[model samples]
Target: MKAIFDDRQWHHDPKHFMANGKVLPSPEQPERITRLRHGAEAAGCDFIAPKDAGLGPIAALHSPEYVTFLKNIYTRWQRIEGAGEEVIPNIHPANRSDNYPKSAVGQAGFHQADTACPIGKGTWEAAYWSAQSAVTGADLLADGARAGYALCRPPGHHAYGDLAGGFCFLNNAGIAAERLRASGLRAAILDVDVHHGNGTQGIFYDRDDVLTVSIHADPARFYPFFWGHGNERGAGRGIGYNLNLPLARGTGDDAYLKVLDTALERVAAFGADVVVVALGLDAYVGDPFKGLAITTPGFGRIGAAIAGLGLPTLFVQEGGYLCDELGENLTAALTGFEGA
Candidate 1:
């Protein structure tokens, strides 16, 4: 398998990932890139540097105004008087904030839903290339590769069209799915992140061409509380195309796989020509998030299960913090996929 990656994503180096009033350095520390690269290399996967595919495909997945907002957020921060640091939000609108502020501070509040995803000098490039990696992976899958991995950082599952939350700027899976659809490969995104892929679900919620399915922690107690419930199916032509399977906190391997099996069944029924996996190893037992207790061995089972479908696959790396088993788990998952 080939692995597409960018070194710049590691430059995001966030200060913290907070939970329940506790502040701690992100568990998937900046060192994550090293571990991911190590895993791919050890797996004997060919690696390649990413090339810009331009903004046309990304624009198909994102709103142009929102894309402009993210690209310029850092530069805009420099122009504001009090914006002495990377952008973070202290204020947010109840619904949608209009009469948007000219200040980068106001834009920060307007765009970022959570404290995660602060903009730094490297963020825009990191975000851009991350999405580019996934989009390229999709292109590779379209070309009939059995499977490929995009080891993306500054994960994209949590980003919305107009907002950046949960350490994501662009929705990589969403962008890739758009590219696959544009290339006339009937595509669907199966997001297996521990946290709900709210941004991806939202982006395709109104279109029939892209079906989004997510299996993650239930929103009632998860990081993103606004969406991810079962009730919010698709709207318009997209109705009945979206699916959310929210496992409860403390869910285990068997439980997780059961949900995945259900998701795969739907994907097959949908007749998707290519499957994009929003793979997140954070569900491993030792993950700092600690909502789910899947083991390192379990990831292999998950990967194999998806591979069993035999569809051309694009694996978009989402969230897997720095755990001791980073390499072991990734290697095992790839092995399982091969076995399948």
Candidate 2:
């Protein structure tokens, strides 16, 4: 596996995200990339830096209105006197009817889906390039690499076509699948992030051309609590293309793998030619934020199972925070894939 990364990008910075009603230290820190970097190196894997491919591919999966909103909003908000900080919505949409503010300040309320993502002046540039990392990984798969990893921060699964949430500006996995779809190959996204891939699911929910599957902690008792239920299969032509396997809190390795294997079987029956794994390591037993008890050694089996698909794969990094065993966990997964 070739790992793609950018050293300068991190969503955990105080300026990058706001959580718990305050500017907490970044959980999506630079060390997340550093850990993966070290893991790939220790596993004797290839590592690559991303090459810019512009926004055409991203525009395929997201709304033009939303993209324009993200790219230009920070600059517009900066012009506001005393609005020098990163833009965050104090009043959410639920606070009012759907008809909210239309200005950049008000638009911020409309575009931002949650408080976790706060955009500073340089946010668009970072997110764009971070997504470019995923695009590059997809391009690598299309160009005939068996599998590659895109360690992008400002994780993208929580980001929908036009709204930002969970420290994500662009849906990296969705964007990568779009790139593959443009190349005439049907793609499937398997999001194993602890949190539901609300954004990726929304992007592909109405289309039959791409399949999106997610396995996460049950939304009834987790973040992004409104979505990720089993009943949200799909709509219109996409009726059965979307699948959600919401596990209970404290779901462990054996049970998690059993559920995931069932999900993987459905994905195989879908006849997808390529696969995108939204690989988030936050489900680890040692993860500070969640109760999921996925052990360190279990990641090897997880990676092996994804590899078992035998399709071209692009592993897009999602939500794994700073932790002592982060690198070790990833190493186990990649090593398992290699050996498998």
CA shift of 18, model 2, Å: 5.4
Quantify all predictions' global Cα lDDT against the true fold.
Answer: 0.84, 0.84
Q: Give the C-alpha lDDT of model 1.
A: 0.84
Model 1 agreement with the true structure over 1-340: per-residue lDDT tens digits:
9999988777676775566788766554668888888887777678997778999877876778778888888787787786646777888877774677776677788888887777778788888889889988988988889899898887898888888889888899888988888899999899888888999888888888888999888889786788899887899999989999988888988989998899999899899999999988887788878768888789889989999888988889888887788877777778778788
lDDT of 2: 0.84
**Residue 136 alpha-carbon offset, candidate 1, angstroms:** 1.3
TM-score for each candidate, following the candidate numbering: 0.95, 0.94
Cα lDDT for residue 189, candidate 2: 95
Q: Give one digit per residue, the lDDT tens place, for model 2 in 122-182.
A: 6887788789999999999989889888878768999988788887889999999999989
Cα TM-score of candidate 1: 0.95
Q: How many residue pairs clash in each candidate?
A: 2, 1
RMSD of each: 1.6, 2.1
In terms of TM-score, how similar is model 2 to the real structure?
A: 0.94
